[model samples]
Target: MTETALSFELPANLAVEKFIAKLSKKTVIELALQQYSLKTFYDSFDWRLYNANLICEFNQSKNGSSLSLISSLNGKVITSTELDDVPAFASEFKDNVMANKLAMLLEVRALLPLTTVDLQIYKINILNREQKTVARLMIEQYDQLKTRLSIQAIKGYDKAYIRLSALLQDEFSLKTAEKGLLIRALKRQGRKPNDYSSKLNLKLTPEMTAAEAVRVIYKTLLKTIKLNEQGTIEDIDSEFLHDFRVAVRKTRSALSQIKAIFPDEHNAYYKEYFAWLGTITGLTRDMDVYLLSFDDYKASLPESMREDLNPLHEFLLFKQAHAQKELANHLKSKKYLTTLHDWELYLKRFIEKEDLQKNTHISIKELADSRIWKVYQQVLNDGAAINEDSPAELLHDLRKTCKKLRYLMEFFQSLYPPEKIKTLIKALKGFQEVLGNFQDYEVQEISLKQFSEEMMQQGTPSNTFLAMGVLVQGLEERRGKARHDFTGRFNDFKVPLNQKVFKFLFAHKSKGE
Candidate 1:
C-alpha cells in the first residue's frame, strides 16, 4: 500500500493554553504525525483545526496512566481512555453543546486529567483551489494526526482487564461469542488445529447464544405478560419495554461476541442454542418497539381529527398480544433451561482448559471492534429496508444491529478517546431514540383502540368503552406530535451522519502502526 506524509505532533510539555492554541491554530495533526500514529478516521475533534478532506493517523503509544488527547490531525480530539467511563462525559458534552451557551471557557483547560496552556494556532490550506482555503475555517491549532497509539505496554495487572477486573469491579466484559478468544488461547497453549477448530472464525453466533440469549426471551416474555395483564399487572410505558428488550438483545450479542473466534463442532450448543430465542425475540421485539411508537403517532394528531386512528390502534393491539404470547411461552418452556445448561457447560469447559491461561493476557475488546465493523458492513452491503408495511418493526431490528456495534465500540473504547466514542454513541443513540419514541406511541395507540371496540361490540357498559376510547384518542394526538418530532430529528441528521458515523466505522487503520 502507498503512504503519504501527514504530520501529528504531541505536547512534550502539554498544557491547556498551548493545547487551546494548538486546537485554535489547527496544528494538532502535525503534532500527531511527529510521533507516527496510523489512525485512519477521526471525529469532530479532528475538524477542530480545519475540516481536512481526508485524515490519516500513524504514531501510536501504548495505553497511558492519565487520559491522552491526540490533536493528531485525524480531525478529532481522540481521547485515549484507560477507564471505561465515557457516558458521563458524553452526557456533559451533550448538555453543554445543546445549551449552546458557551461556558466562559470552551477549551479543555477545566477538564480533568489534563492541564491548561497557551492556546493559539494558525491555519494551513493545501487542498481545493490550486491550494487554497475553500472555506474561512475556524482559526485553530489542533493537529489532525498525532503521536503513536498502541496497547499491551501499559503497566497494568496480571491478566487482561476482562478477568482481572472481574474480582475487583464485579464486572466482566460482556461476551457474545467466546470461541474466537478461546482459539487465540488455544494457540498460545500450542493446541494443534483439528476438524474441531477449523473454520470457527467464519461462524456466526445464532440470534442468541443458548446460555445468555434467554435473558432476552425472558425479558420479552415479561413484557408480553405485562401487556397481557388481563387488567391486573401495571405495565410500564413502551419506552421501558423498549429498553428491556434492547438489553436482552445485547445479552444475545454477548454470547455471539465471546464465541465468534472458536470452532463450532466442538461447541455442541453452538448451532442450536441461539436459533429458537432469536426467532421468538426477533418477532416480539419488533412488535414491542412498534407498539411503543404507535401511541406517539396518534398523539401527533389533534383530538378532533383521528377517525382512522381507532381502527389502526385496534388492529395493532390485537396483533401485538399474539406476538407477546409467543415470547411468554418461549421463556416459560423447559427447553430454555436445557439450552442454558448446555451453554453453561461449554463456557465452564472452555474457561477451565489449560488453554485458558493464554487468554489471561488477551483483550477481547480488540477482537470485538474488528468483527463489529465487519458485521455492520455486511448488513450495510446486503442492505436493510424500512417502509410502511412494518416501518417500526424494521427499524427496531436495525437498532439491534446498531446495539451490537455500540457495545463493541464501547468495549475497545480506550482504543479511541472517550470524547470520540461518546460523540459517535450519542449520535447513534439519537437516531435510535427518535425512531424509538415514534414506535412507542404507535404500539400504545394500536392496543387501546382495539380494546374499546371489543367492549362496544359486546354491549358492555358505556363507561368502559368510552373511557378506553378517550384514552385512544388522547394517544393519537400524542402520536401526531411524536411523528413530527421524529421526522424533524431524522431529517436533521441525514447529512451530518455520513461524515459522523459511516466513515468512523468503515475507515481502516492498521493497529496504530
Candidate 2:
C-alpha cells in the first residue's frame, strides 16, 4: 500500500529527545535509530535526476550497499536495489527499471558521485489506545548541521494523521522543507544542480565587433577546459577527456574558420598547439569509443565467436591505460600550463587592443555572410565532383570541409532569422552525420588492421586475429552502407528551398540595384 508523506524542517531550538518527550505525554511514541556511513548521491554530470525531481542515493553500512531512487516531490521510493558494487556505467546494470531509466537519461555519460554525507535517521511511530500505529515521523540529520523531518500517514488513517500533525505543529514551529537533504548538503558545500554544461551559451549582439565575438567564444572554451580538468585528473570517466578534446577542437576551429578576426600569426601559433593536443589525446579517445561499443561489436558476430574477442578487449584496455598516462603527464607539464596562460593573455590583449585590424572592425554580419557563402559554394563544388568510384581520400577531404561549414553555421547562427537558420542547420547536420559515419568506419577499419599486425608480432592467438578480421569486415559493410546513403542525404541537404534560404541569408550582392 502507498502512503502520503509530509516533510518539515525541525526548529533549531528543539532537540529530538525533548520533542519525543513532549509527544509521549499525549500518545505513545516509539523511537527507532539508524546510522548510515558513506552515504553518497549520484547523478549525471548535468544533474538529470535533480532536474527531473528525483533523488538517487547510495548507502553503505556494515551489511552492504543499497541504492534508492526516490521522488523528491513526494519522498516516495520509486525503486530500491541491494547492489554488490557500484556500476561504472548505467549499461552495466542487467535488465532492470533503474538501469533502463538511467540508460535513457544518461546516454554516453557515467553516473558520478556528487556529494557524500553521513545520515542519522530517527523513525518515530505514533501509537493509539489500541497500540495501533497511525502516524509516522522520520527525522534525518545530515553531517550534524542539517535536520529534516517527514510525517507520513498510515494507510486508511487520514483523520488520525491530521490530529497528530496538528499537535506536532503546535508543539514545534515547523516549516515546509523546500529541498531534499541531498540538495541541502550540496548547497552547504557551495554547489548547485545543473551547474555545468559543455555547450556554448554566449549571448552575442550584432553590434559586437568580429574580434569581440571571437573573444566571447574563446572565453566559453576556456571555461570548459577549467571545468573538465578535475575529471581528467581523477580519470572518473572517459567523457572528461572526450569533452576536453572537443573543447580544444572548437577552439582550433574558431581560430581557423573565423580567420582574420584574430591576427593570422597568432592564430597559426595556437592552432599548432591545439592540433598537438588533439593528436596526443586521439588514441585514448578512440580506444574509449571502441571499448564503449565493445558489446555491440560482439553482438554482431556469432555467439560462439564472441568469447574469442576477449583478447581484443584486453589489448584496448592496456593501450587506453598507456595513452591516458601519457595524456595526464602532458596535461600536468609546464608546456600545457604555459600554453593556456599565454592563450588567455593573448585574448585579453587582443580584445583590449586599441589599434584593431581591418577585418576585426568589420561588422560580424557582413563577415559571417561572406565566409558562409564562400564555404557553401566550395562545398557544392567539391560534393558535385565526387562519384561512386572516387578515392576514399576524396570523401575524407569533403567531410572535413563539411565540418568547417557546419561549425561556421553554428558559430554565427544567432545573427540570422531563427527559423530559417534552424532549418538550414538541421539539413546540414543530417548530411554531416552520414559523412561522419563513413569517415569513422574507415578509420576504425584501418586502426583494427594496424592493431592486428602489432598483436601478431606480440604472439597473439590466431583466433584473436580471426575475430579482428570479422570486425574489420563488419566495419567495411557499414562503411559501404553509409557511402550508398550519401547521395540521398546530400540531395536532401542541397534542395532548392534550403539553397534559397542560404542565399537569402548569406549570399553576397553586387553594389548595383
Tens-place lDDT digits, model 1, residues 57-150:
2122333122233333332433333332222122244344421321222221112211111212332221232442222112222232122111
Each model's lDDT comes to 0.41, 0.82
Candidate that scores best on lDDT = 2
- Where model 2 places Cα greater than 4 Å from the true spot, the runs are 3-5, 26-28, 34-38, 61-64, 91-97, 164-171, 414-420, 504-513
Error of 1 at 189 (Å): 39
Model 1 regions lying over 4 Å from their true place: 1-247, 254-259, 263-334, 351-366, 374-397, 411-415, 453-459, 473-487, 491-506, 510-513
Every model's TM-score = 0.37, 0.90
In angstroms, the error of model 2 at 152 is 2.6
Tens-digit lDDT string for candidate 2 (1-513):
546477787777877667778778877888855555567998877677777888888988776888878888887888788896778677798649878887777777778888888867778888877888888888776655557788888888888889877776776667778777786778888998878876666666778888788788898888888788778766778888878888888888888888877667888999999899889888889999998889988998877888889888999999889988888888888988899889988888877774457678877777778888888988888888888888878788888888888878888888888899889989988998999999999999999999898888888889988988898999999999999998888889889998999899988541111
TM-score of 2: 0.90
